[model samples]
Target chain A: MALVFLVLFVAFLLVLLGRRKPALVVGLIGLLFAALMFRYHLTDQVRLSL
Target chain B: MQLLNAVAAMVLYSVVLGAFWFQFGDSELPCPLCLLIRIGMLATAFGLTLNAFWEPRPLHYGIALLGAVLGAAISLRQVALHVVPGTGSFGGAVFGFHLYTWALIVFSVMILAIGAVICFQRQFEAQQSPAPSLVRFAGRFVVILGLLLCLANVIAVTAECGVTGCPDNPTGYLIS
Candidate 1:
């Protein structure tokens, strides 16, 4: 999942260099990937801290 | 504004480099949460990259806002884990704060900064021209640099995690 973010971010840059719209698409993908990763981390690594 | 955006990107890249220094120099492999922080930070930086080179729009800054918010949440989670007595902490401390704590601070600043910047209506003027040559040059350099660093991160994570998920407490690269 983290790799997905990294790869999408790099793709964001790669597409970002030449175009804007596709780069935005890539950015959205990054956000989606981050969200999924965040969700997984929260649930899988759930720990009670006081 | 474009130049300033580029400078902001530079600051972010510097922080990532610092993380790299700790990962490679101090030989402390990043835990799972740590990698997420980097991902969030990079996503936020991506927004700045757009603002520096392309048209500065509310949408661009929105990306920064969302990234910061997400990053802040992750950082807070990490902080909570180590806040309790005897829970201990991950990695080493810099300037007396763990990296996750620093990440929280950085994300806080990014949220405020992005919120403040997005309010300037003049930046969204439809008649705006392309960025100056210097800004364009800087943008290209930053993007290229980011690509290289991100490639490095991909390789590093692969070596560290292998085919399985990353370990919670990583002391050495799994592939090694």
Candidate 2:
């Protein structure tokens, strides 16, 4: 799951770089990855506690 | 823009060093894998500062490539430590992936992107010779100072880590 988000984030970065729209695209992709990772990590914690 | 980049690089390096100190003083001691990540961060910070100032494209590319290599190794080790517990030691298992992994990945990506930009910018600058002397001088100064700061932080962190023994918590709940 984390790997999936990592690949997507890297692809988005490559696209932004190719298109010369790095700032916006990179920022959005970074945020998306962070959100996904946060969700996954929190879920792990909740599961462990339960 | 160069100054901003240099400052950001410096701040990030300082934060990493501070984290190391906090870990030694408060939390559990860092394992070999954690130390590798710290080394990678230090290298990336150094490269970023150098890339910000150095107009020569090749030099920037070299620095960035070095940083990327270090980052890739550390990130891979970090992932492996989490996924394949037995591959590393108890210390490695204790110090699993955290926010530091994300920071390492971001640092690597930033280095690669900046390297590409430097290559493109170099070509543009070549067409317009006689670049501003002050800008070049300032960039050189920043690069030198940034390298020195990075070296100092790396030394401090390495010495501190060496002085402490790895702490273990069988329950894996304790902060230390």
Candidate 3:
């Protein structure tokens, strides 16, 4: 979802400004957002493909 | 140098932004696979953004490479899905190719390009020293652009899918 990138972008910005710790935290949040998005997409659709 | 990497990411973001605009303009709805491709693009962009800001390292390039590989895989999967003789393609096609096909090409190119760029050890040294004003400006500009794009997608996706998750085949914005 866009939230994933939104979180990661903020994290990237944090690192650019010389904030490493916060960037890591934000990056993890982004990953979490991505995981949720993936779960939702897969579970909702539940398609089978080769 | 680092500026070029940032610019590369900028270009990638621009392409996705164009697609986002086209989606709204043409009333095309992105399916779940399409959404994954976008995420893959963002993941790759994230790695490149890191390289642009910090000192260029093999690890950073590795991150970018990983994202590209995964994205390419997803793109390929979608292409396979619609490649059947009778099955129709998703949304719309651009220049006779679906967006997934383009995504595969972009990620493939990014993989090669990153490898070529990583071979140059000189650029890595450039970032250790104080970056020039232009590089700094470019870095800020690219990140700001990314922020804005993310904001737009977040709002747009929310309006499109709401909290229930995106539909397999979306037709229009859903707020209920």
Candidate 4:
């Protein structure tokens, strides 16, 4: 998940260097990925606790 | 405004360095989520450093906002993991607060700072034209620090996590 965030952030940076709108779009996508990762993490924690 | 970005970048780098201190000096490998938070900090610092080099834009602040929000969420989750009455907190206390608690405070402050940037957009714009001489000098330092921290993170993560990736609860470096 950390690697995923790093890749997405790098992509966001690259896209940002070229275009604004696209960069924003990429950032939103990154946010979605983060949300998904967090959800998975939370679920895993729950399973562990159970 | 640019000065603000430079200073913010420096401060973020210091926090990351503190994380590195724990990782290398203390031989405590960070959990996967902790690493994610560190990456988030780097991303935020990178955005601020970028803003220091160029005119402040909504996009730059937007990136920082995303990083802070993501990092805060992860930190909050880490805090939640130990919130139960009987469970002991992870890691040793730093200044009477756990590292994750410090992260939450830092992220909260970062959110407010980003909000300030949004609120004072006009001020940032007004100051952009001349591109203060101080920014020219400080910007380089921010860039160097940002890169150094990023490199250190990459090296440390690779050493600990390896190609297989980090364990959920990392105990130490996994370099075999």
Candidate 5:
């Protein structure tokens, strides 16, 4: 999770540096990590009861 | 102008999330389809966040496209879940169909519309001169991110759904 934040921060910095393409690339990668985390949350547990 | 659209998207997504929370409270777990929508929402939020920081136009476009595609996919799934009883649990069946699903569909359309506007507006503005290098770079980045995120999300959902003997509880008990 922290790594995701770190990546986002770096991506933002890249954007600030006028590296818009890389920033977007890194942000998408970060989102992928987030999705994986969400998947882990969903599958690792046995059942989700409301 | 871009910020306005991004803010609007964020507002719409917040409503979607709020509706989901309201219908199911905090306890119920999301199904595979529902999880996909959540991923969509997160992507939109991330896009909005980047937009808020004035990252670049490409990032904005990417966010809008990602949100739109995810929204469309989930809405279609919700429609299927509504039409087909046991195809997949649509979560608590709030508002005739899953509220989040409906929200995702609506949000997706909005994002797509916003994306179209952004693209056309840029083209119109650039008629006389070349698009600024940074702006063009941003656009490419966004389009690529949108495509990749959508693909990754679909793969994740597919893998989860393919597993045998998945739990049947409507409100996902996994979170609890």
Candidate 6:
């Protein structure tokens, strides 16, 4: 989850610096991270049963 | 202008850093929703950092607004979960406010501030020229710190959760 934010932050920085292509790539990666996190959270699969 | 934005970044980072300290100092592990809220705050700070670096466009504010709204939604959901009488919160309180409540306040303020900036565009417009070297230096410095903090968080979360992922009520690290 934190990695997702890191990638997203980097994408934002790239966009601000006018590096369009890289920003787009990083943004997509961040979205992917967010999606995975959302899926795991929703499914309740990540938490231990304990 | 750049100086102001850099200061904002510092303040924003400080808040997040404080949260991290509290989490570790109090020996509390964050749930998924808590992580999301932190991401939201980072996104808010990213928006402000953009303002310092580039021209003011609707896109920049849009990113911040989206993050803020998402974060607020998660915070609210958590509040709803615990709002029922006799429901216990996950962590200890800070100044009588839980972390999620503070998150709610921050997200709400960021939304309003971004909305206001969008409405009063001229007042917050960026300068035409490239930022001065000093301004650029300050901006980059703070951004670098943000990047480092994010990286640190990634490492810490990975260490805590491992491949299986964090338990809902994480008392200690799962792997070890």
Judge candidate 4 against the unseen true structure and give its global Cα lDDT, from 0 to 1: 0.72
For candidate 4, write residues B73-174 as lDDT tens digits: 899888888888899877767999988899999999999988877787474555525666787778767766665565566667777877555678776666
Candidate 2 interface RMS: 13.5
What is the DockQ score, from 0 to 1, of model 6?
A: 0.28
TM-score rank order: 1, 3, 4, 6, 5, 2
lDDT of 2 by residue, B103-139 (tens): 5666667666666556555442443454466655555
Q: Across residues A1-50, which tens digit of lDDT does each residue of candidate 1 receive?
A: 54665755566576445888778777878888877877776665475547
Better of 5 and 6 by lDDT: 6
Instruction: Tell me which of candidates 3 and 4 scores higher on TM-score.
Output: 3
Worst 10 residues of 5 chain B by lDDT: B167-176
Global lDDT of each candidate: 0.80, 0.45, 0.74, 0.72, 0.52, 0.69
Off by over 4 Å in 3: A28-50, B126-128
- Best candidate, lDDT: 1
List candidate 2 segments past 4 Å from native: A1-50, B4-8, B11-15, B84-97, B122-176
For residues A1-50, what per-residue lDDT tens digits would candidate 3 score against the true structure?
Answer: 55665676687678667786676567556655665665565553435656
Q: How well is each residue in B59-176 modelled by candidate 3, as lDDT tens digits?
A: 6677677767767877887787788889998867789998989999999999999999999988656444588888877777776776677667777777887755677888878863
Q: Score the docking of each candidate (DockQ).
A: 0.50, 0.02, 0.41, 0.24, 0.07, 0.28
Give the Cα error of residue B96 in candidate 5, in Å: 3.7
lDDT of 6 by residue, B62-141 (tens): 66676677778778867766877899886778799888888898788778866765786573564667667888777677
TM-score of chain A of 1: 0.60
After superposition, which runs of candidate 5 have C-alpha atoms over 4 Å from their true positions? A1-23, A30-50, B23-26, B85-89, B93-95, B120-176
Task: Record all residue pairs in model 2 with backbone atoms less than 3 Å apart, i.e. clashing.
Answer: B28-B176
Tell the DockQ for candidate 1.
0.50
TM-score of each: 0.92, 0.49, 0.85, 0.82, 0.53, 0.81
DockQ, structure candidate 3: 0.41
Q: 1 or 6, which is superior by lDDT?
A: 1
By DockQ rank, best first, the candidates go 1, 3, 6, 4, 5, 2
